[model samples]
Target: MITKIAQIEILPGQEDAFEKAVTEALPLFLAADGCDGVDLQRSVEHPSRYRLMVRWETVKHHTVTFRASDAFTRWRALAGPHFAAPPKVEHVYPVLAH
Candidate 1:
């Protein structure tokens, strides 16, 4: 499986707005071909920071399947403006598991 982590920092008072936007935007992933699942988490120490952890069958599933789809465009249109800056995205592969 491939994991994608997006670190989003919301502008000061935009936390509630960002979270609401993300919640509304999440359904777009359901239409993605290889999207296994996605989870959103917030930083306890930093209310304005959030993390999106997504799992896909392969990296190409995200880079190709999802990114190429119209849903992505809509998703971005809905969620893009809430970002403090462009999110920092990272891809990772699991090395160990319990």
Candidate 2:
């Protein structure tokens, strides 16, 4: 599996707006082809920071398939204004497990 993590720092007072936008935009992932699941979380220490953790069957599923889809564009457009800056995204692989 592939994991994609997006860390976003939202503008101070725009937290509520960003949350609302993410809630409304969550459904777009339902149609994604290789998506296993996705979760959005807010940091307890820094409420204005959020994380989007996505699990995909393959890296291509996100880098190519999802990224190239119209849904992605819509998602971006809808959430773009809520961001304090462009999100920093990272792709990772699990190396060890308990």
Candidate 3:
């Protein structure tokens, strides 16, 4: 599986609204093609900073398929306004525990 992480920094004082929006948009992420799951996590040291973690079956499932679909448009519409800047996103694979 591929893990996609989006590093987002919210606008000042918009944390609550942003969180609510993200919660409401969870289904969009889940409904994407090859999507496994997604999690929105807030930073303890930086209240306005968030990391959006999404698991997909492949990197292209997220980068190409999802990004080209309406869900991506909807996702941006929901969370784009609150962003301090465009998110820094990347995909990764899990490391072996052993």
Candidate 4:
């Protein structure tokens, strides 16, 4: 599997709203094809920073398939407004895990 990590910075004062929006959009990721799991984490030192992690069967599952779907549009609609800047995204393969 591959994991997609998106580092997002929310607009000041919009942190709570951003988190709520992401939580409300969980089903979009869960129901996506080839999606294995999804998680969101906030940085304690940077309250406006968030990391969105999604596990997929392959890189294409996220970049090609999901990005082309209506769900992608919906996701952006829900969360885009809170963004301070476009997110930085990357994919990683597991090196070791329990």
Candidate 5:
């Protein structure tokens, strides 16, 4: 599997609401084709920053399939308003595991 890591930045005072929106959108990610798991993590030194990690069967599942789905539209609708800037997204494969 591959993982998509999205570095998100929310408006200064919208962190809570942004977190809530992502929480609410969990089901969307879970239900998506090729999606294995999803998680959101807050930065220790950057309160307005977050990382959205989603495991996918392949990169195309996220970049092509999911991006073209209605769920993606809904996700953006739910969380887009709080974005301070466009998210920085990348997909990576596991290089090592204990």
Candidate 6:
């Protein structure tokens, strides 16, 4: 599996609403064709920051399939407005040893 991490920084007071939107959109990720699972993490030191981790059967599933689908638009509709800036997204493979 490949893991895609999106580092998000929301506007100072938007965290609550952002989390709510993400919660409502959780099933969208799970229902995607090649998605395995996903999780959202909040920083204790920086409450306005979030890390969205999504696991996919392959990188193409995220980069191509999901990104090109209506679900992506829906996700962006919910989460995009709260973004302090464009998210930093990347895909990585498990090291296993680490």
Score every model by TM-score: 0.93, 0.92, 0.96, 0.97, 0.98, 0.96
Tens digits of per-residue lDDT, candidate 6, 1-89, equal 99999999999999999999999889899999899999999999999999999999999999999999999999999999999999999
How many clashes in candidate 4? 0
Q: Give the C-alpha miss distance for residue 71 in model 4, angstroms.
A: 0.4
Tens digits of lDDT, candidate 1, 1-98: 98999998888898888778878878888668888888999999988889988898899999998999998898888777888889999999989989
Best by TM-score: 5
Total clashing pairs in model 5:
0
As for candidate 4, its clashing pairs are none
The whole-model C-alpha lDDT of candidate 5 against the native structure comes to 0.96
Considering TM-score, where higher is better, how would the candidates rank from best to worst? 5, 4, 6, 3, 1, 2
lDDT of 4 at 77: 97
Q: Candidates' lDDT values, in order?
A: 0.87, 0.89, 0.94, 0.96, 0.96, 0.95
Residue 7 shift from truth in candidate 4, angstroms: 0.3
Clashing residue pairs in candidate 1 are none
**Candidate 3: stretches off by over 4 Å:** none
Per-model RMSD to reference = 1.0, 1.1, 1.0, 0.7, 0.5, 1.0
- In candidate 5 the C-alpha lDDT for residue 74 amounts to 97
Window of ten residues with lowest summed lDDT in model 6:
89-98
Compared to the true structure, candidate 3 yields what TM-score?
0.96
lDDT of 3 by residue, 1-98 (tens): 98999999999999999999899889998989999999889999999999999999999999899999998898889989999999999998988856
Listed per model in order, the count of residue pairs whose N, CA or C atoms clash below 3 Å is 0, 0, 0, 0, 0, 0
Q: Which 10 successive residues of model 1 have the least lDDT summed?
A: 22-31
